[model samples]
Target: MTSGPECPLLFLDVDGPLIPFGSSSGHPQDSASDTWTSADQGNPLLTRLDPELGPRLIALGCQLVWATTWMEEANEVVSPRIGLPRLPVVEWPASSTAEGPRGLHWKTRAIVEWADDRPFIWVDDEISAIDRLWVDASHPGPSLLHRVDPGKGITDADFSAFDDWLRLVIPR
Candidate 1:
């Protein structure tokens, strides 16, 4: 099978989706159930990353792209720790001009622009109704703007939703 725009893109955000915060149990913050990596780089939160997530994400069969402020650093630090190979990074344009309607997240427009008519799933904690509306109006392809809970990060439920969507849209 050849990969193309039909192969959905999964735009991943590090802060909220991967390194969840504010949760009391089963989250990376628990420390007891989490594993620490030697490549901390003085950022303790890096230790909270669940290495298994990489395989889980890869299994989804989407082209994973780093869509966070971490940028290239995500490839260098986050990828290895999470057992993910280097993936594409979404570089935000060097300006503050992509303001959609009032409640949209700053990254909304850029994410849509990056997708460029390709089906994509944008996973971020800050998504809002405006962003969804904006994407629905602007992006001309199947898209899932999933908003993960910053407190819990990505859960099995999230993966289930992704699986359901992928099977329906990309069909493996």
Candidate 2:
């Protein structure tokens, strides 16, 4: 598989983007999918996943990587439920060191480092102004830091934004 500078990387977070969690039980009407597999029985939250999202994400044509705390487990559990194949997982740095700026999320630095000059899109609910500013200052390639609503997960609007940015940044 061609990685490195050839393809744009999409760093996906599981807690919010994949599994929609709200005060009540329901998910976004449009984003919900009926696809469910036997593998999802282990985790109750897994039921919230819209299985069809896997195909949509694959259609984006970016190299998908797991950026969630779930780590390798993302491949083990989430992938099967969503109909995605095993994806690369980001190896987080040891947390014993100092934390950065006040608003900066812990994963921002690692995400940028993993990209290593390759263009990337980071989809997570925790992104803030501080993360954006840091990536702009530190990363050398085009980047899009998109924040999904934890309560709603990914919506049509988010996919549209991703598609629009990708069209401009990478050619088919």
Candidate 3:
């Protein structure tokens, strides 16, 4: 994932951030059921993705990158469903063994490396204090590790926060 100097990078996670894991009604509040039939798809969770989010995310003017276990499949399976283009996907390092400080997410180091000192935001459900501390100390540029609720995914409040941060960091 090469740095785009013009816009801050937004490392997006798919499972919990895009597809809310569990809801009180047992389905996402903004479920894509009307647009997509989950019966045919191998992964039912994909149905939880709201198509409206794509335009909202694009409106933020950040360079969005996939940072999920979904990998390239995020492009093949999730992109069209959410009206997103084929953005760059972060490739996770092999060897599942944890390499960084305890409580640091496996994707944290790779994501920071991908940013390469550029200002960036990581939107995921699993971001932890340790990950935040590590990034604060190691990453030279500005960064925001915004953790989403797995049960609710991203809400209007999250978008508002993103808009607020992007305005300060990129300045239009």
User: Top TM-score: which candidate number?
Assistant: 1
Flag the better candidate by lDDT, 1 or 2.
2
Candidate 2 has its poorest 10 consecutive residues by lDDT at: 27-36
What TM-score, computed on C-alpha atoms, does each candidate reach?
A: 0.88, 0.87, 0.88
Candidate 1 has its poorest 10 consecutive residues by lDDT at 28-37
lDDT of 3 by residue, 47-106 (tens): 677878999988888899999998987887788888899999998989656588888899
Residue 66 of model 1, lDDT score: 93
The reply for model 3, stretches above 4 Å from the true place, is 1-3, 24-40
> lDDT tens string, model 1, 1-172?
2347678999999998999886545644333324434445577666568878999999888899999999988888888777799999998878756655877778988888898988999999998888899999999999999999988889999999999988888765
Error of 3 at 113 (Å): 0.5
Compute the lDDT of residue 63 as modeled in candidate 2: 94
C-alpha lDDT (0 to 100) for residue 98 of candidate 1: 61
Q: Candidate 1 vs candidate 2: which has greater TM-score?
A: 1
lDDT of 2: 0.85
Q: What is the TM-score (0 to 1) of candidate 1?
A: 0.88
